[model samples]
Target: MLLVYFLLWVIFNGSFTLEICVFGLVIAGVLLGFSCRFMDYSLAKERKIYRHIFGFCGYCVLLVKEIVKANFGAMHLILTQREEIEPVLVTFHSDLKTQVGKVLLANAITLTPGTITVTLEDSEYRVHCLDRDLAEGLNESEFARYIRKLEEEKQVRKG
Candidate 1:
């Protein structure tokens, strides 16, 4: 995981020789210093991050589909004779067992049009939607379920 993090850091930072050397020393020092804290605590964080990046690949495809659908839905509503719009706020519990997972869920909600995650308390997320149909779709199922599964799979793989 540290290697992956360092590689990603190097890639993003242009992989400069000086920067890589500097980052290598810094990362080594930090890992050694914090080794006690991570001992027996598991590599959940590493797994979560690894899966999170891969998760984005799937999400990118899903996002395109969702965005197109949302655009058409919004377009239909606007072009058709819809006078009284029923905006709604939907509250639901997230299945994400970690803070990182919760954040991912919130970001997913906000990225999709007509839906915004207003707040997340512990595991509960309060999301605002543009209409009842949108609210209904979200309330019926927590999207975090998918994220949770991915995170879980990551943890298992690390084992």
Candidate 2:
């Protein structure tokens, strides 16, 4: 999946320098070769990876929108005499059970504004949020469930 992304990106935004293109293609081929062994290009695996990439892309778009809203929220708080800011740390346990899922959770947390994943101890995630509302929302559910499900979905296709 990563190899496919690199190849497409190079093709789309390639600078048209033959030497650079050659280097990039070679690197992409090598990475693809290595990943293919692990990825085991079965139909189910391929479908799962495709779905994950699509979902991640969609998640990223939503995250961008949330970031814009958070920016506005932050700005409003800054402009107002009232303090809407309430820094807090929240912890929650999850069932991701894989490094990939944990990494995705960390990344998704980072992608959302005003929230940062501070640690992953076992299945527990310690998140630092800029305010109480974000903290409360985060604490209310297993926000990383989708990421965990994505990882588990792939594990079923493992060779």
Candidate 3:
């Protein structure tokens, strides 16, 4: 994790001077210390990261599709049926077992135009939607299921 952080620092800084490298090392060390205390180290192992890399990429592609669909849905609703906008607050339990997966799910929901993740507690997410249909769709999202599968895949490999 420290190595990755250092590499990212180098990339962002666009420098390889001795002083910059030393500074990056210090910063990376501090960040890594905090990450070690708060993050699941098992999930950050190099082998595990490589193992799930392809699947994670695939998930991102699917997420883009969902985002586009949500945007068009919201546009259609706004243009054609403004009066049918029945704002709803929906809460549902997420099946994703990893912190990373849960956070990704929450961010994805918020990125969609018609929905926003209000709060996440444990495995439950509360979302505010522009309409009842959007809320219902969020409650039954395939993206959530895919994220849950990703979490389970990691656990299975770790075990």
Candidate 4:
């Protein structure tokens, strides 16, 4: 996580100056220290954590692709076939167990152009979609499945 913060800081700064690097290191260290209190420090040494980190990075890339696709689809619908759009509220049960996983999924859904996460109650998510087809894959999406798998792995590690 500190590495992630440092990389983001470096990227945002867009420079390799010694002063910026030192500042980023100090800030990231403080943030990581504060975050450690709320997180399971024991997991820091676990292989499962590394696996989840890599999986999450891949998930982020997948989310960006989905966002692009949704944007084009929504734009096309608005420009050429607005009449065919049947806005609907769809409710689905999410398989993700962790709060972080569930929140990530909800935010990802909301980030897509044609969908909004209306509510999240327990494992159930209510989403408003601009089109029915956009909501159809919510239940069977790879995002939920991957998060579920990650949660399962985490539970197994704990046990």
Candidate 5:
């Protein structure tokens, strides 16, 4: 955090001198102290955030891949199986513990091409799928897996 603050100070100042560097160091230290004292910020929390950054990036990549795959699947269903399409409503319970995890799962489902989350109440999710095939394995999806991993990481930290 101090390093980040110092970098920001240097970037904003546009020029660096010995005097400026000393002042920037002092300012960054003061800001870091203030954050630690009053804002509940700590090095441990910063490290945890840094660790989650890679996991979040991986989840984002998986989301984009799923979106593209779903788009093709939906397109195929619409073009070739329109008359035989079997739309379904799927209700499933998830084991994710955090509200944020549940919400993330719900939003990820809704973001997919052939599925939309109709309701998310407690641990239960009701999803409307464009076809039965899309509804299959709605509960134990990769999105849910990623979210569960995130939830577990938090739990591990707490324990």
Candidate 6:
């Protein structure tokens, strides 16, 4: 965190000198100490974040891929199969343990082109799909799986 703070300080200042470096180091130290004292920040949390960084990056890549695929699917439905379009509302339950995981799942569904999360209460998700095909496998999607994996990683660390 100190390194990140110092880098940000240098970047924002637009120039670096010996005096500036010394000042930035002191400021970064102060900020890091303040966070540790007031914000419950610790090196353990930082290590945990570092461990999950790759998983988060993979999830992001998967999200982009899903978004692109959904875009094409939506386009095809709009351009060639407009007459057969059937919008549907589907409800499904997820086993994701954390609120963050559930919210991420909901947002990922909504971010796709052909689907929107109508409601998310507890573990149940109500999503509106542009077509029935889009609703297929909606309950156990890759998004949900990735989020479950992330949640499991947290549990594993705790255990």
Cα lDDT tens digits, model 4, 4-110, are: 77999999999989999999999988877777776745335545567667778878888998899999998887899455779999999977778999998999899
lDDT of 1: 0.72
State candidate 1's TM-score: 0.62
- The alpha-carbon deviation from the true structure for residue 32 of candidate 5, after best TM-score superposition, in angstroms, is 5.6
Candidate 1 — which pairs collide? Answer: none
Per-residue error (Å), model 5, residue 110: 0.9
Over 1-159, each residue of candidate 3 has an lDDT whose tens digit, in order, gives 778999999999997999889999999998888886787564357566788889999899988999899999999989995655799999898767788888999999999899999999998999999988888757558788888788777788879
lDDT (Cα atoms) of all candidates against the true structure: 0.72, 0.69, 0.85, 0.84, 0.92, 0.94
User: TM-scores of the models, in the given order?
Assistant: 0.62, 0.58, 0.69, 0.68, 0.74, 0.86
Candidate 2 residue pairs in clash (backbone atoms < 3 Å)? none
Candidate 4 wrong stretches, greater than 4 Å: 1-51
Total backbone clashes of model 1?
A: 0
Query: Judged by lDDT relative to the true structure, which candidate is superior, 4 or 6?
Result: 6
Instruction: List ranges where model 3 is wrong by over 4 Å.
Output: 1-44
Candidate ranking (lDDT, best to worst)? 6, 5, 3, 4, 1, 2
Ranked by TM-score, top first: 6, 5, 3, 4, 1, 2
Clashing pairs in 3: none
The stretch of ten residues in a row with the least summed lDDT in candidate 4 is 40-49
Q: Report how far residue 43 has shifted in candidate 2, in Å.
A: 11
Q: How much is 90 displaced in model 3, in angstroms?
A: 1.1
The alpha-carbon deviation from the true structure for residue 103 of candidate 3, after best TM-score superposition, in angstroms, is 1.1
Worst 10 residues of 1 by lDDT: 136-145
Better of 1 and 3 by TM-score: 3
Compared with the true structure, what per-residue lDDT tens digits does model 5 show for residues 47-151?
A: 978988888898889999999999999899988935688889989999998898899899999999999999999999999998899998888889988889888
